[model samples]
Target: MKLNTNKAVLKPGMTLIELTIVILVLITLISVLFIGAKAYKEGADNATCILNQEQVQKAVRSHQNMNAKNDTESFPHDEVFGATGIISEPTEPTEPDNLYAGMQDDVYPVVGTAYISCTTTNGNGPHAPASTEGW
Candidate 1:
């Protein structure tokens, strides 16, 4: 077979503007993703905060209700809202150490807003009911 040498071989390459546009597009996409991630994280934290507040409120209400049933008025101790026991899976900035802003006035998590705000009279936190046979 005979080959023709009249045609020129060519290779396609990106021009400066084309490459710049690609880079800009990539940057925009990355920024959008980062923004979405930030928003999602904030939303997640907010939800967690709400759940913690609800749990603490529930524990407090239960304690109060039980006491009321027995013709007594008492609340769980502060220790109930701190580490070693009551609270669990606390939000990002608020550790178990600072779960309470005050004892019954207005409980605000150190990290986020306690939107629902715990009902008055010191008491506290979150954790699944569990027990162990160990000292």
Candidate 2:
């Protein structure tokens, strides 16, 4: 009978510390991915908000031209909003507690040559051209 002892042969699986490290790494990667996704979503939301503002601006311009209203004149919010109007309801900003979203009713079209500026001032910030901005 021959007994063979080999110290070179080791367990194939990772050690406890190695496993913990891998888990931590995976967690880190997952967190990073989540952060990136969140940022991307915010950016996309911002863009959509901007486009909505532009659409509303164009609609307001159309309304003004059709009704012969001047920029200094304040138009009714319902004039260009709704399905029957030039454009449907403009989408609000996705960010929480957005000033623009809250002040949709108070917004009017006379700001800075009817540029439609939002007063959010938050991180997602200033979703200008709010639905009421050009109304």
Each candidate structure's count of clashing pairs: 0, 2
TM-score of each: 0.56, 0.68
- lDDT, candidate 2, equals 0.63
TM-score between model 1 and native: 0.56
Which pairs clash in model 2? 116-129, 118-128
* Off by more than 4 A, model 2: 1-10, 74-76, 95-112, 115-124, 129-135
So what's the TM-score on candidate 2?
0.68
Could you give candidate 2's per-residue lDDT for residues 79-121 as a string of tens digits?
Answer: 6777676777654666445434422542345544443444433
Cα lDDT tens digits for candidate 1, 1-135:
888977887779999999999999999999999988876765555555556656665554544454453322334465345565355424423343544333444232222223133222212333212221110
lDDT of 2 at 24: 99
RMSD of each: 11.1, 4.9
After aligning candidate 2 to the native by TM-score, how far in Å is the CA of 119 from where it should be?
A: 5.3
